[model samples]
Structure formats: structure tokens, C-alpha cells
Target: MSRDRQRLLDYLVHILEAIARIERYVDDLDEVGFLTDELTQDAVIRNLEIIGEASNNIDKYYPEFSAQHDHVPFASAYEMRNALAHGYFRVDLEVVWKTLEKDLPELGLSVDKLIRQLMDENSGL
Candidate 1:
């Protein structure tokens, strides 16, 4: 992998780790509702933004990757991240909760697949 791809992968790992942490704290409606506080929500949203930014960078470096993975929802992920980063004041906790419960897991799995692909390619596997 190129240096840029490595960096992006690092960021992707960070995003995954952050998501795992948030997931540990939230397993049901009560936990999710309780974590609606600004600090906790902001941390989760920020990690998502980091994930989106890393994915965007990967797309720029490897357009073929983007082409092969068009269904990954990269643009929507970035847009949601942008909203969280720039419009935190207006961010809806329910939306964040829904995304964490739905989108993040799928995104994490996709990212892991991409990372594995990159590694296998680099290793000539």
C-alpha cells in the first residue's frame, strides 16, 4: 500500500475503535437515550467524521476502489460527518442514534473488507 493508503487505513482503524467503544456503552434504548448528552454524542460524531474523511482520502487516491465499492455510501457518510462537525448545535440525537445503530456497523464491515483487500494486494496474495 502507498503511504497515503496506510494513513487512511490508520484513520479507519481509529474510526472502528471509536465505534466499538460507543457500542460498548450502548446496547439498548435506555443506554442510547442516556448517551444523548452532548459530550458523549459529540465524541461518537467526531469519530464518524474522521472515518468519512479517511474514506474520502482513500477514494481520491484509489478511484478504482471507489468504483468497485460504489455501494459503500461514502458521500452520504461524509455528508453526515460534515453535518456533525459543522452543525453540532443543530444535530439531532435521534439521527445519530439511528446511524450508530444502523450505519456504523455496516460501514465498519465494509472498511475492514477494504483494508484486507489492500493488505492482500500489497502482499501479492
Candidate 2:
């Protein structure tokens, strides 16, 4: 694979894997019950940070590709990461949970589509 494509693919995989981990961590727990424990919350938050960082990396490294596929909220993820990383004490956990539960599924699908597009485009290059 080309270096550029590899970089993009790495970010995509990081996001998908992070989502998988988040799902696994919250697999049996509902939102109301899940936040009581700190371990799971911390794990999920770290994974979310990973996702946001990966999204930020993609935006910086491949702006054209990112702009072409704007359905995914890469900027929001980055902003979330910024908030979590920079404002750790002030983050709204409810918002994080809601976003993970709702927004992530659609984002995952979009990431998959972007990966496929990257693979198809890079295969010819």
C-alpha cells in the first residue's frame, strides 16, 4: 500500500477498533447503569479519545478525502477529544454516552465506506 493510503487506513482501523472496544465495555450495561462504575467509563473515554485523535489525523493528512466524505463528523470527534483531553474535569459524561450510543453506529458505517473507497482508489495507484 502507498504510504498515504496506509496512514488513512490506520486511522480507520483505529476508529473501528476503538468503537468495538467501547461496545464491548458497555455490552451488558445501559446508559443509566453504565456510568456508575469508573473503570468502564474510563476505558470507553480513552477509546473515544483514540477515535478522535485518529479522526484528527485523517483530517490533517487527507483533507481532500475527508472533505469528499463529510457525512462523518470528524470535526466533532476532534472537538470531543479536545474537550476530553483538555477539559477532563468538565466533560459532560451524558453527552459522551449519548454520542457513543447513537452517533457512533452511523459514524462506523461511514468509516467503512471511506475505507472501501480508499482501498479502491489506492489499488489503481
Candidate 3:
């Protein structure tokens, strides 16, 4: 495998790990519970930053891959990361909760699928 492909895989793995961490952090919490818990909110936001950083790295280092996998929301991930990391004062818990409930699962699945596809293509499986 090329070094770039390996790096891409690494970024994908990072995103998956972040997604899992976010899921675990919010396990049984409802929106209200998540809103009330500063610790969990911080944890979730940190993982989200990780996801955004990884996505940004992938988009930067592998434009072709990012272009091909248009469904993965690579741009959105990084944009959200900027918002969460740099604009924390303006962060809305309700929007964050909605993203957690609706977007993360789909993003996780999309990333997982891309990782598997890359592995399969490389291994001839």
C-alpha cells in the first residue's frame, strides 16, 4: 500500500474511534440529560473535534478520495469542527444534540463503509 493510502486509512480509523467514543459517552442520555451534563458535553465535543480534524486531514492529503466519497461529509465535518472548537461560546446544545441524534450515526456508517471498501480493494478480498 502507498503511504498516502495508509494515512487515509489512519484518518478513517480516527473518525471511527471518535464516533464510538461519542456514542459511549452519551449511551443512555436523553437530550435533557446531555444538556445538563457538562462532562459528557465536553467529551462529546472533544470527540467531534477529533472527527473534524481527521476529516480535515483526509480532505487535505487525499483530495481524490474526498472527491470520490462525496457522501462522507468531509467538508461539513471540518466546518463543524471549526464551529465547535473556535466558536464554543456560540455553540447551541440543541443543535449539537440534533446532530448527535441524526448525523453521527450516518457519518459513522459512511466512514465505516469507506474504510472497508479501501481495505477490500487493497487486499483483493
**lDDT tens digits, residues 1-125, model 2?**
88877988999989989988988899898988777868988898899999999999988988997898788888899999899889867878899889888998888888887788778877884
What TM-score against the true fold does each predicted structure earn?
0.79, 0.92, 0.97
Instruction: Report the C-alpha lDDT of model 3 over 7-117, residue by residue, as the tens digit.
Output: 899999999999999999999999999999999999999999999999999999899889988988999999999999998678888899999999999999999999999
- Number of the predicted model whose lDDT against the real structure is largest: 3
CA lDDT scores, all candidates in order: 0.73, 0.87, 0.94
The candidate that wins on TM-score is: 3
lDDT of 3 at 83: 95
Q: Local error of candidate 1 at 67, Å?
A: 1.8
Q: Kindly report which residue pairs in candidate 3 clash with one another.
A: none
> What is the C-alpha RMSD, rounded to one decimal, of candidate 1?
2.4
